[model samples]
Target: MNQTAVKRLYLMQVGSMPEYQIPIVCYLVQTDDNRNILIDTGLPEFIPEEASDFVNGQDVVEQLASIGLKPDDIHMVVSTHYDIDHSGRHAAFTKAEYVVQRLHHLDAESNPRFVANRPQWDQPMDRIRLVHGDTELLPGLELIETSGHVPGHQSVLVRLPKTGATLLPIDAVPFGEDFSRNGQDDGKNPDAEAIRASTVKLLELTEREQIGLVIFGHDRAQWEGLKKLPEYFD
Candidate 1:
């Protein structure tokens, strides 16, 4: 059996917003085979004026540096969605292949709200690798389509050698309270049905795979209890 092993998993607190107190974070997964996979890039300098006070000084590059990594060291960058908070700093990883859903790319390009913040992700389109639906980036790293908050938002699932399974439901299940309720209709999420279905799907997967940990996207309370960078989950 060709079992893939994730050697290390680090959570980088790249940015934060005061309104929610949930630190915007990014996840780095180092596989035994020397692959460095990054999930989401935190907020960019240009955010909504209302969120101006939410900006954290550390950019994605600086956050990666804290763990002895450079932006170019990332082999792949998986965007859970194209929301400014999640995809803003994506341009930093110029050397990495930007993996995103086809629908997500289209939506970001056409949606006026996202288009206004285009400068943050104003990188060459050639760097994008658009996939339809769910796709596997590596042996144990899977991108699960859990769109709800946005038309093409997705989440990540990692099966580690030591940690078993870890589910990152990104904005699809933004907070612990939402996950606990099976899903909540945050005003921003236009499609309540999709959110409910996606959350249910994640719960099913967690139970079936016996997932060891499930990370919610913007859970302030939950984030406080997690081990941040430097101290990783092996």
Candidate 2:
């Protein structure tokens, strides 16, 4: 029972791999009351040496400026997971309280799989708000616990005023193809069972809610169809 609705949802394409046809994205959710919640940080100040050619774009900070916002303007940051591309510019947002799932912060802290990405997301821990299971972050914004891509990955469900409800199944369902399928054992992620279960969970939720639109995690094909930055989904 939300009293207010999300004003706008801006998708930012921060990085892309021409070889693999992959595009990295981060989202900004603007509440009716003018609160800003950035979903994931795009990339760091410097791209990795090996991935330099494949991944290239303006970082999250630069992208925010295009929409007349700075890092400090964001009140909250919803970290879906601590993946390399997702949690890069977290420390830049000095004013935001980071939101993350409890298990993700713990497991990633102790037994982190990505050694290179550890330093980027490990900081600003003092301002973290760790929630368990599905949570209504605000009146119109909800956090969907879809942990399949990583230890405790989560997705977002935003209810916009005119557009109705939109689901951003980040990493949990990487491509648009995943939406129609009953299972998600794509072999890309290690946990096949978790992927399948989480996929089904999202499917059920989408059907029950009659979601207005669904945005995949890193689908390059789907990415082209979405409105980005200055143009938003509202």
TM-score for each candidate, following the candidate numbering: 0.91, 0.93
Query: Candidate 2: where are CA atoms >4 Å away?
Result: 1-4, 50-54
Candidate 1 off by > 4 Å: 1-4, 46-53, 180-182, 186-188
lDDT of 2 by residue, 118-187 (tens): 7767766678999998999887799989887887899999998888999999989988887755656658
Model 1: per-residue Cα lDDT over 43-142, one tens digit each: 8756777447667657778878877889899988988887777877887787998888888888888787677457656567788888898888777788
Q: What Cα-based lDDT does every candidate model obtain?
A: 0.81, 0.85
Looking at model 1, which ten-residue stretch has the lowest summed lDDT?
180-189
RMSD of each: 2.1, 2.0
Best by TM-score: 2
With candidate 1 superimposed using the best TM-score fit, by how many Å does residue 191's alpha carbon deviate from the native?
Answer: 0.9
Q: Residue 93 deviation, candidate 2, in Å?
A: 0.5
Candidate 2 colliding pairs:
none
